[model samples]
Target chain A: MRAVPRCVPCVLEIAVNTVERAVPEDRQKEAILAATERVSELYRMEPTPQPPRLGTEAQRTVMKYSEDPDPYREEKRRANERAAAVARELESDLENIEDPEELLKRAAAAAIVGNTIDFAVAGHEFDLDELREEISSAEFAVFDLKPEDLRGARVLYLCDNAGEIALDKLLIEVLVEELECDVVVAVRGGPIVNDATREDAEQVGITEICDVIDTGAEMLGLLATEVSEEFAEELSSADVVISKGQGNFESIPEEPFPDVPVYFLLRAKCEPVAEELGVEVGSNVALRWEPEDENVRRWREIVR
Target chain B: MRAVPRCVPCVLEIAVNTVERAVPEDRQKEAILAATERVSELYRMEPTPQPPRLGTEAQRTVMKYSEDPDPYREEKRRANERAAAVARELESDLENIEDPEELLKRAAAAAIVGNTIDFAVAGHEFDLDELREEISSAEFAVFDLKPEDLRGARVLYLCDNAGEIALDKLLIEVLVEELECDVVVAVRGGPIVNDATREDAEQVGITEICDVIDTGAEMLGLLATEVSEEFAEELSSADVVISKGQGNFESIPEEPFPDVPVYFLLRAKCEPVAEELGVEVGSNVALRWEPEDENVRRWREIVR
Candidate 1:
């Protein structure tokens, strides 16, 4: 139940790293020195033109969560351990698999398993039967198949947060196993709220599993507006898209992609999304779409 | 500077207390426990139901700043220091005053002096000349003044955050000293963006110093719409009104009160107010208003 709030500090840690990367890599030490001074001046109400906005942003990023005196060092350590476990699992699976498609399926399955375990431990109830039922009912499915489905279809796997990317990798594996598709994994290019970044995807070996690209949007739902020309081309060519999270639900346009199949997989974190899915908040919903199909048409009508 | 942010957690502590007090004193503890759980749930989501309209109010109340940990502890320590310093200064000044009004003046002076010191130490620059200039020009004044002010003009001293009411005690002292007038100290009656609560006032000794009333508004600027009938009558009858902080600025209507004067004292933490005062963000501005005054008109026109 508190997992979302607890996730804030982790998100901030990544954001801090991302912000640090904004400074030229060659001037890393200098930038940090300057950042300290800038932060102090910001705290002191000094006359700095750029300080207010930057200060607010930094304040928002750092102060999003209450600072635990011990600072969740132990929880972070455990998370690293889990990530390492997932990495090892993927590595071993990769050793046995010859085809890229098969590797993707195994990875995706691992992600689902890991996420289910972690979420359950974190007090979230996981209903495996319901999950399977939704997956089977998905129309115009956007998943990576295990070397078997990559004949001509395109697949897009929209990513989530940093530590969660490894779990996403597992989903991609499943896509590869079942769908012989050209898969593209999308990540946010810049910060909007708390979402996964391209760096996070790369760090979790998502780039190795598929052709990864920046969506140029703050939210996954807002991907249409954020997609670049090259990324848009990939999306247009893709037969199915697997969008992860509530942000995608908010931003994905309704009219333009009328016929494209999009599977939205997210844990409903707020009322609006939960109401739309006819589920309680924190419940997971995977709604699938097929171009010109009745269900897709119904969803389009409801969203519009 | 950061002191503004520090105000949020302090106010929230009082907000919790306010919710506790909403029930009978005997059941207060139980009510608080239940409210905390509800608040925790709300905190996980948007925290407040209102959006952009409430953002500024939220920012003012330190709700934006409350994400920092253990702020109540830090503010308690500071408040104690401020109260002690004020008491000592007043004790020394008591030797020179025989009349009750004079004693109130001495107390008010001591509070201002103490607050000035604290504000300066906290890196807020104070401009006494500007404050005096604004106060002298007002026709109607609302003060969060001491009990002594009840004998003179009606004063409405708008309160800011929790724990700072000790400092407000000094302002009340002045209302008692300078004028034989009515004084009404206003606080938010219900859970509001980050403004002070009636309970916070009581804890900080504000209730003892003067008549404490709920303004029924989230921010001071919204007073016109949200203030209760009794408070509105007091405002109508008052000759001079003093408003505190940016919240007041937002809630108070821009229309001039030809017979009434308003003196707005606040630290400009946001952009619009800073621009209005022709000062940088975080600068304290004491704006005096005479409903039909040409200069006040000019200032408003220039800003517009």
Candidate 2:
């Protein structure tokens, strides 16, 4: 074999491939568009190599594993176990609380502290005091929140990635302890992207602290597929719904439950969503509302 | 909306979209695997801060334009015109020659040089003398001359980006002038990946030198669908086939023509192919011959 010249087409192959595997299955088209934008941004921001080579084999291997079914399931199982354990721990905390509002406050505090530790280790940084203040001030004035609304509400905390499971655990604890909510921490049924799987949740003790379920590997995001019969019953009867990550946002249509108060937490990593929110890309968001009402005011305030 | 801090998942969504686009309709699963391999490689090589993000809106816009029906047809039309022009130029060169052996030698040299320059820039550091010496020394070689066989030849061309289309132009010239072979110069169908497009080929006068075709809008690797009748006829009658780039290798199957000789010119950017070749990933290669018993000795020597 004679040596061929290294060229631009090869480099581009690597770059495109790298970006492609990073996306989840349901959002493949959106991901491709985002990758294109990022590449263009990189070119404009700096003097990149003219023709980026395709990703190296090692890189491709990692991407393959990231999307493998076994790893994803393992991650989910671990998270579920962890959530179950946390729920037990919170059971004792709940017994100690007398006031419903105070319990919610305590649960929210635990969630913040727990999630902060997890995020920090995962290489994320945030202002703890500010976050706490924000949570403390979360009033029904912005949206609608009634005691009956959250009582025994079925909450699903969809996880994202291995390292982030600990944070999800914290959030589950709050729903169970403070809100007195029936919580089900759902891990992806199989691996599609980097989202948590059943095993990952178990490993982090998330399953130990809450009821755990699988979303059957559907990439519909917030518009999660019908849960197992038992889980579905819980989901349909629940009053409050919480979905984590933008995949859920894309999958869950904006009008599924007009009356149910759903809280969506995600970072705006792509343009379409960011542009819709009128925020810079890569900004984090914690949007809450009932699909039935025109919550444009609430959305505006949150985006601002 | 409060900042959600789950941008990683959002980025994953974009990656998925990119992979879906890169994959052809029929080979979605293989394309997905190829994409996963490429992205995984990137994750392993680079740090997390350069965490993979999705394509931007601008990139998607470019992709849309590339896939537009009219532009695709126009690019093909222009490419045909360019190939005819190159044929005319080769005929002029042949008019001055009279010996069959000399004509064959010139044709082979032209094929090698033309293919090389098709995806590379002019004034590239290609050592023409070295390439010529390698081609002339080969014995018992097979030529993959069928256009149909071009569909799945795992070609890998090392590239330098944009301004180097001239190199590809020169290589196409050689394919016509020396080898007296019918050729297809494949490019990125749309603008998502940084590579020569049908338009790029037309812009650099490449269409005039050879048959111009799109490798679809694929970014991970090259994939060969059913050959067009015109190109298939050329392949059925030809004696040698040449392919360029790592994308070509990823997209196409390796043994499209079990009996004919196929030449792959690529830079090893990813692991699977590099590992198979026992070469350092990212190294360039110009591998020749059929993977059949008749060419065993030649194959072993070249691959070795």
Candidate 3:
């Protein structure tokens, strides 16, 4: 979806967060000022871009100012380690559930819980200590496409953050083994915030079960114009797309996926996203949006 | 103080609020988009103006885009009426306090409670029903300047919001009748946000006790270069300045007031303002700052 006015401040704040990590203390003030200036320039240009595009540009500007390629390198590592421990703890619990449908719902809920590990979104706070309790009791605001919908389907999973991807592996396992679905997962081409890469997928053991491909874009979300030929091919061929987190939730709708049924799993962390998905700000959402879904009609009207 | 990264989102949000009120329903999206674009342009300018300055420009841009001179006219009127009722109810309670100092502190606290009536600041929510209870038990974070400091002094009170000014009258009454001080009140020269104007002062019975002058600028805060000659003369001669609300609290220190002992009486509404005051966000402060006070030295280092 195209950006509403609320996105400008959040986009800039995310830039500031990145700058604090990338630049040293003494030069941080100068670097942040320049980064914000460039952000303002980008906003004022003709035909204002989507928020994800703006967010990517702001991150790029900060990196350029500080001459740092990956500001979130250390943070990503720590997040992955934390996510692994939580996933391992959750593995035994999943093994106990008898019904395949209940196990699939529980796994999806756990993956949605993992979306809370993100650090780039402004004013979003997460505590790993609460993850277990949250996963057990999570309620999806929109749960249209179910376990039966993905049964024996060709599925493509879009990963969001580093630590969050580990929990996503649980849902992928459910799809490949329990539901008899052919699953492939895609990470970003390079680092942008804490978004998963090939390294993250390998670290989280996502590569061991299914194929992993990079989107060939360093943006917050996978833009149709920026993704590699392989990713585009994979995206078009998939019968079902399990788009993870807020970024992919936003960018995926911009593409022409008339026949592909996409299930959006995320914690609605911001106002605009929550409003678009018809949920409260902090609600966990597992929405199904496609050409036939009601939200697609509303979204088309909004962007137009 | 200069604008921080956190201020950009709030400033834009405030602008959006203004645009929603100022523009027609069908045309709101176009107006809001243009207003935000202009706000970005303002942020990109040289020297990077303070958040208050940026806020003023954003409001003006929305008004200009919609061709509406005062979108807040009805809201300001309602605020003044509500404030008057609250003030009338508070008069008897304030009259019962026996000690002069205790009465002064209670009255100041009541006036600070009135600062919550503001609507222009982003994410600021105020409930008028709780005004009485909040004023009764309000505690000051910094209460350095006492009644003795203002006794028989030529006090200049800088007013903030419309409904807020009615409560401000409680403190002004304390200054004029109880403390035997020569009092002068200053409102904004023109309507900006819901800030008190000459009409607001007259509506709230402020004209009955003392002289009321305007700052001669339509900006969110008073600038030294923007005030009338009469205001400049009165500002130079005042023994103590009771600066009200966040806007004045921000702009008063930007001046070269080496000798003027300014008592800032307002709730710390935003983080940057709260950080500059060495207080927690949402704390009620009645701080005395001059060249001699500790905060002035710290503020000089910040603004430099």
* Candidate maximizing DockQ: 3
TM-score of each: 0.37, 0.40, 0.81
* DockQ for the candidates, in order: 0.02, 0.02, 0.27
Predicted candidate 2 versus true structure: per-residue lDDT over B102-181, tens digit per residue: 44344444443433333222233545455445434423122323324333333222222233344345445444554354
Give TM-scores of chain A for all candidates.
0.52, 0.52, 0.88
Better of 1 and 2 by lDDT: 1
Name model 3 segments beyond 4 Å from true.
Answer: A24-48, A73-106, A113-139, A198-211, A256-259, A269-271, A278-284, A291-304, B24-48, B77-99, B116-141, B199-210, B256-259, B291-304
lDDT of 3 at B113: 87
- Candidate lDDT (C-alpha), each: 0.48, 0.44, 0.79
lDDT assessment of candidate 2 = 0.44
Q: Compared with the real two-chain complex, what DockQ does model 1 have?
A: 0.02
**Which of the two, 1 or 2, has more TM-score?**
2
lDDT of 2 by residue, A102-150 (tens): 6554444444333333331223354545544544443321222344557
Off by over 4 Å in 1: A1-153, A178-182, A189-198, A216-220, A223-226, A290-304, B1-304
Query: After best superposition, candidate 3 residue B191: deviation in angstroms?
Result: 2.6
